[model samples]
Target: MPKSLHPDICDKLRFSKLYEKYAQTLSNILLYKYGDILNPSDKVQEAFIKLWENCTKVKPEAVKTYLYTTANNMMLNEVKHQNVKFKYQQIKPKDYTNESPEFVMRKKEFSNRFEQVLSKLKEEERVAFLMSKVDGKTHKEIAETLGITKKVAEHRIYAAMKYLKNNLEELNKK
Candidate 1:
């Protein structure tokens, strides 16, 4: 893969100027929509890279629309997948009845409890937990990225789970 889009490639048939201008525009749109869920700039960059790879097929005028559409679609899919996972996990959201004081209190309590439990974990265990359970990285991938053996990755993840379970139990009693 080419590390960067070459000036020569961009200069061809005025595609370069269009790509530059619209790339920024597409990135801004993506940032506005998905900045909270994921890295919007990363998604835009990925879309641009895809377009650049197929530059022969893509017209300059169409690049902006295509990039924005592609990034938004990808972000939508991500959100859908997250929703499904959250549902499957059976983690119920706090009940809210139109901005009541009780609802606000419950919401705050949940947030504080979650943070308190998470903060007790060791750094590596916390990272392993988030990567595996939150980001959905497989043990093998986590092991490879963290430069540890697969067994170590598994151990770290299990330890984190045990810690969280115990903490949740302790919280329930209080």
Candidate 2:
């Protein structure tokens, strides 16, 4: 067992000291396990908050277990909520009526062009763009999902849009 799992000499765990010691490690563990689905850092912070709230009940030696359990439960709830949301969205009908044939044709052409341009972008940019535009994820959500900063996610999405716009303009001329 790791020494970190054991209690220190002091019976009561200090929030600031405990956070300083374990925050990054806990975040890394959650990220490694659940990065694709949710924001690990947010979950880690939530776990710590829960720990702080229940500090008196938790044994110092069991703090690590408590954190992991809290984080896992929070993630599970998020997954369940996402699943319900997905199911509800799946049941919603999409409307395509009241459109001219020419408009539909142009839309199809634009979509094809968009796909082509997106494929040509760098992998990171393409991913960010797809997550933001196609998947309808916000910049922060994309950053969390990709384990990147929000600014980086925004930049990648912007670059992708610029690339697509330039390519689409060139395509129009051809």
Q: TM-scores, in order shown? A: 0.42, 0.44
- Number of the top-ranking candidate, with TM-score as the measure: 2
lDDT of 1: 0.70
How far is 90's C-alpha from truth in model 1 (Å)? 36
Best by lDDT: 2
- Residue range with the least summed lDDT across 10 consecutive positions in model 1: 1-10
For residue 119, what is the lDDT in candidate 2?
A: 69
Q: Model 1 TM-score?
A: 0.42
The residue pairs in collision within model 1 are none
Clash list (residue pairs), candidate 2: none
